[model samples]
Target: MTETPTATKEKPAHRSGLAAATREFVLIVVGALIVSSILRAFVGQMFIIPSESMQNTLLVGDRVVVEKLTDVERGDVVVFEDPGGWLGQEESGQKRGSVGRFFEVVGLLPDSSHGHLIKRLIGMPGDKVACCDAKGRLMVNGKPLDETSYLYPGDAPSAMDFQVTVPAGHVFVMGDHRSESGDSRVHLSDTGPNGGSPGDAAFVPLDKVTGRAILVVWPANRFDKLEIPDTFKDVPAAAAPPPDKPSISLTPPPK
Candidate 1:
């Protein structure tokens, strides 16, 4: 009997070791979650392309990294919250439950099903944006935008003609696949149910922009850094129009 006891004497020690290992693993997982949450809340986040709106530049299903702190400039691809129901529905039509949405908020999952939208920032505040010059190019503050570098093949700059002055503190955005995309041009006439102004419904406020999309990260083969097109560099600064001179109305001399 004494000899048999020797074989089982170390069982408690083995059990203790296993328990310690499990505890360590749980701690590691919790730590990782905390780090991920912090990074996503304040630094950057991953978003998936949900439509062909930005096609040829970003395909559907492509995951992109959006930098939260970067300066958004003209021609930068940006992700923004839907302003005043601007985005009616998602192309994929995917829905997420509350649990899944929680994970997305914590950076544990990609928010592909959310109502956010991605588009190229075409006009900055106070810029005049118009469609179709003589050569069928978009005009930004009197400069013709050469969009061939990123526009979908054989796609026109815009099929629908429009002209708008981007109001202060707002931006005008458009998609590369102009014909298929319902971007700023599509919302130009949306006055909302409350009879809000046109620009109020169409323009995206600066505060609504989440971040600038800077990289394509999904599918491995499609990985690439997004860069501003050379055409944006050639765009001239928007010149300020002269202030209207105060009209001097001549009052009838005591008629």
Candidate 2:
């Protein structure tokens, strides 16, 4: 031991501090990633407006926060999975390669390119929805919807005429820009896989709805909370059909 002690090699204080700082930084990043993932998966998610379907209300390039736990109600704007190839050849602005998709899933990027559609819930299951009831207002279960508050200025409630009873377990949806939107009304006659009838493919299944859009988060100037217009407030519950009538057909004859 008295002999010359072997030279002790110790890490410099600065080096040790650098290592600790690097580890802390990495941990913080990972923790943030986990929290974001949880929020995006269970609580809420961000979506980008890909088309002009919901003009004035939701313009293309607008970013919105979709609340997953909220109930989907009539007049609520919602994002949903495309039902039965309804979004034919529609390109998602955020469509990316594998690596890009991974980032989107991890909540690192905006979910603008996903294969989903956005629209206002117009009719609940079992509601008879019809277009242009004399005053050009949409009628649901005999009650007219005064859509002027949300309908794009100068745009009619619908350009084409249609009347269909929303089947159970599904919803009838339409965009604010009815003229430009390819919504439930457009697909009323498209037969689904089961091939039941013309109106069978028009409704979006309840399960397909992702979430209700609660806020617009992008384009700072456009920041605002989406609210249910007063028009939806006055809609009375659908009237029950008489027992003697096996079926209820509220659709008026086409001109």
Candidate 3:
């Protein structure tokens, strides 16, 4: 009634195959989890707007989807690092606990120097930006911008005046809600030496740009894809040579 030697040898081979299959299954599950974590960390991050800096365009409590593409152009809404001078000097967020903040500085968690700021790119590197011409409109490279589409009704383009040439590899940004926004113009007179003189404003480094805000993905009613504005439609590319005509300079910032 005992089995032959051939049958007994085959039993061990069957068990070996089963063990190999089980090992493969476990590895697949682990690999999937790791990939997902990385994607959440860098590819696309969800954020809630905590302030009214971009009201009408983006409201408080609205969640947005930010992509990691860095080739953003003018009139595009973008999220960037707060530059510490703007955000608190120390990390004080839920994600950046005392221990986590320490690690973030040493490359443990994400860099805490990175902060969340959303605004529109008005002027790119090496471009001349001025505000309030004869008709009270913002101008770039002698071309007036019609911000009627995005500018909040009843609000002027900007109450505080600014005129500056964005540094090489930097950008000039502003908020849709001009009156409430404390953007590049707000820091023109910062105590720092690099804050720039009365008429000029500090520039935002290109490396600080995190990503472009491509959509308002939360709150079904507010969901929509963001598009580049026509205001920059007639405006020439950054590489184009400056026009021969003179571009007016708005009132300089306070001394």
The global C-alpha lDDT for each of the candidates, from Candidate 1 onward, is 0.79, 0.80, 0.69
Task: Please give each candidate's TM-score.
Answer: 0.84, 0.89, 0.71
lDDT (Cα, tens digit) per residue for candidate 3, span 36-140: 556545775566665667778888766777777458888998878764366532222235588866544333344332366778999887577877677888887
lDDT of 1: 0.79
Per-residue C-alpha lDDT of model 1 across residues 114-210, encoded as one tens digit per residue: 7788999998877777776777788887888889899999899988777777777778899998877888888776764456654456778889899
List where candidate 2 sits over 4 angstroms from the true fold: 193-196, 240-255
**Against the true structure, candidate 2 has what lDDT?**
0.80
Q: What is candidate 1's CA lDDT for residue 226?
A: 91
For lDDT, candidate 1 versus 3, the one ahead is 1
Judge candidate 1 at residue 49 and give its lDDT.
Answer: 89
Lowest summed lDDT across 10 adjacent residues in model 2 is found at 241-250
Output the better candidate (1/3) by TM-score: 1
Candidate 1 segments exceeding 4 Å error: 1-11, 192-195, 241-255
The best candidate in terms of TM-score: 2
Best-to-worst TM-score order: 2, 1, 3
